[model samples]
Target: MPFAPEKPARLTRRRALAGGAAALGAPLVTVFAPVSTGAEDQLAIRSDILNVEAMQIAFDEDFSTLDVSAWGPGTRWIAHTPWSGDFGGARFANPGERSPFRIVDGNLRIEARRDPEGEWQSGLLASVDPDGNGFSQQYGYFEMRARLPEGPGVWPAFWLIGKDRSTATAEIDIFEFYGDKPDGYSSVVHVWHRDGRHYSRFHRNAVFVEARPDAFHTYGVKVDPDWIRFYFDREFVWKTETQPEHRQPLYILLNLALVDGPTRDATPDPSHMIVDYVRAYRLD
Candidate 1:
């Protein structure tokens, strides 16, 4: 079953990046309104149709035990490859381990480090067989608190996958950042598989406030039938409303990748994407 590179996805990385300059800041981009009255702190619930419930948790060592159940049954733990080593590959780095994934000191630390073995690759961990996860949701609120890694070519992202990885039904990138651009983070929504490929339709919104790589910021996504919204530090940053396949069940994914091909940069010796907590919510 040879993969046909020609298959039309809802969007491709190239199409999304080509128009990157123009789409960097669209009106749809959410400008953080100063944290207002107490009412704003409440979950923005959709009227009558459904009552949205907020699932919340603060990560610490105790959480490691509870999260083990979230992965589902028969899931195998995938470790970073040896060639990549603990520092990751040429484009990315993870400290403590090659893939930057670990549980220690009461937190899930996704760190990158300079390749001790001189293998400067970054780390990546996905559901062994994402399709078999047997879990996907049509609409829900997803959130995570993490400390990002900064360095050139380090791409860290918390995103989603459709039942079929090859054909894109929809991909909701909650947050993606590069070490080069330290102050800003990006949020995008993608619907792949069409020929015209709505690549340019994908957007990138900025976080005007500084996001220090060492501190924890809550990154979130609120997905409903009509719209998908992104948030940082609990503030809205961007959204996509014209969802053609919003009803499909989309699974979750998180990874730190290096930019490939000719324009690659000097891989960071060691880098890490430390995630403090991840939570999912639904209508109560």
Candidate 2:
């Protein structure tokens, strides 16, 4: 069956904290006035979303420094057509000196640019390192604060894959944004079997926002034994009971890709996806 992202509910201070805490199996602690008044108060609300009880900080990458120990550069990703065909136009390139991926001002920036030969080159980062050393978890809450790029042909995504890539692969897409659809993004889950079969589900939703795609927003997902939930900007967006039932650990992947879509011809020379942070928490 096909799936689409439902329109998100209007996020209120009370709802954001209370709902998120409940989802994490935690109790809400702070009480706020019906109408919040200052920047300090707003910051407090945001903090609660991250520090919910019954959850332990498993992995946190602020990108304050380019720590290759925690994240592997582009060499960890391979350049090939997605799904075994030459469909997507962009080629994933190995990391070089400021070529496609970089760290600046405490943020990790992944850019899609045209090479000197006029070929599309972009950045892809993975939790698995080139030496086959990396991090993965069975089930947890994963979140990323990022600002996406705008303009045609640009695609930025944060996703996870099972540790075993050879067969029966499991994947979870936290968020995928297309520049052409400036107001929405997609989330999906897939379980690919070794016999060339697959089970897939997806949700594409239009966000209610006044800012452009460049504005920073939080995208998150909670994976459990029987349920998978998604959130945008700390607000609950969607939930599903049909899960991948993945038993092995899963690793993270982030990329800025170019696809053959309506916006391809109009895509700008350089498009970027700026990431403020990526974090994971283990459920108690």
Candidate 3:
């Protein structure tokens, strides 16, 4: 069972007489309000729905320090755009110094640039944790706020990968943006990958009413021991509860990639994913 985060209780002390002085000592104590149960603390998921509990500020400007130790180590750090196949002796940009992935003005900026070969090379931040933190978590909530760039062939996704290389435990995409079609974005979920194959069942076509390139919009997932719900800009857009696979706690991931998948085939120009924040929460 997943445990909730509770507030601390207030402290108190009674007065006592001093040995030498004929006076009572002042009672010194600190009081604290009880922390709320994870389920009790809610985020306005939508005008009609609410997320029972949600993580807050999981990653923000405060996380300016990048500790490679905190990240997974199995994955290789590659620079240059995403789609460009790794070639021999190609000089790559430094991962930590490139402007494509940087923190500025309280937001995370990741840009995708068009390479000389007319292929899109963009930023990608994936995990190396063989055992993601949440691989065992059956259910919880995930959320993110971001602004996507405008252009074609740009894929900005907030997703997760399973620790087991042999099979994908479960994958959830909070938001996926195809830069060319700036009016709408997608939210999807996948399950049970095996033998280099993956199956997906998801919901799509959630139009982002907010001017995507102009402002940041909130995206989230409300996962329970039994159910999973998705939201965009406080609106409950899609949900899934068909087959329950309450297995493990899955770690979190956020990245911006220039993909030429089924969504789009054009090479996007310099595009960006401006992330205001990323967060997650578990139920009490």
Candidate 4:
């Protein structure tokens, strides 16, 4: 449901070496262009190396084992709130009982709890499969190593979608964290059209963390073909080429929404978002 659309039009920035040189605190350079499509694919922005060697993993989940083969619990992720609903402010239960998902020890929590009639119940997971079969990929590097969950209507996320859900644009927001904006986070990339009209590219940083929003970091994205980087903890903060790209095959989504902004009422009933790992590479 957070696969937003409709509000896009001005976002063609692409020339950012981590937001105006990390807002004046400078000292982290290294650029290298060439990828306007003449294709020799260059883009090398080394703000002190973490380039992720070529790439090769191709899927690795360290949730210790709840690998429903590739994930698809929470009843394959159903929604309810506004239209397919669920853009936050609660409501998404279903995966048995008050399902809010869990995996414990190896991480992969997701909760948001409240119900007993007070109504909140959360948790969503998807990789396809619920009659839609599973797995999808196109350009990779996707990652996640969470541990977020502060309070105020928390809205943790890790996204990607486009295994063809009839087309809600092709999203890719590898991070969303909004527990009242502890330190900041948000990343997006949507490209839709089929008369629905859209084209987005976003990044809403504010990081300088010294840990504590639960701790564990690392959020990433590196879709290629025409670039779409964005990482944190591994540095290299943002990148985009934006267009109608995203050539099919994409599927992975994790949720913990409950937004209505301004603490949405000041969340905090059961809030969680742990994770701990979710990888995917391949591009070597």
lDDT of each: 0.51, 0.65, 0.48, 0.62
Ranking by TM-score: 2, 1, 3, 4
Q: On residues 1-284, what C-alpha lDDT tens digit does candidate 1 reach at each position?
A: 00112332222243332233322432222122222224432345432122233443221222372232222344432332211221222333323334455676666665544456644455554332322543355577777777787766666777764454333345677877766677777666665443334332344445635547657788788777876776777766555563655556666556665544222345465566777766666633
Collision pairs in model 4? 81-85, 82-85, 89-258, 129-133
Residue-pair clash count for candidate 2: 1
In model 3, which runs have C-alpha deviations exceeding 4 angstroms? 1-48, 52-94, 97-99, 115-119, 127-138, 195-198, 209-213, 242-246, 261-268
Per-residue lDDT of model 4, residues 220-258, tens digit only: 887777777787877767677634447667777777776
Indicate the residue-level lDDT of 169 in model 1. Answer: 44
Which has the higher lDDT value, candidate number 1 or candidate number 4?
A: 4
Candidate 3 TM-score, C-alpha based: 0.63
Model 4: per-residue Cα lDDT at residue 95: 55
The digit string of per-residue lDDT tens for model 2 on 93-142 reads 75455457688888988778878888778876677654445567888888
Each prediction's total of clashing residue pairs, residues at least 3 apart in sequence or on different chains, is 34, 1, 21, 4
What's the TM for model 2? 0.73
TM-score, every prediction: 0.65, 0.73, 0.63, 0.31
Q: Write the per-residue lDDT of candidate 3 for residues 165-200, one digit (tens) a residue.
A: 333345666777666666777665555433223344
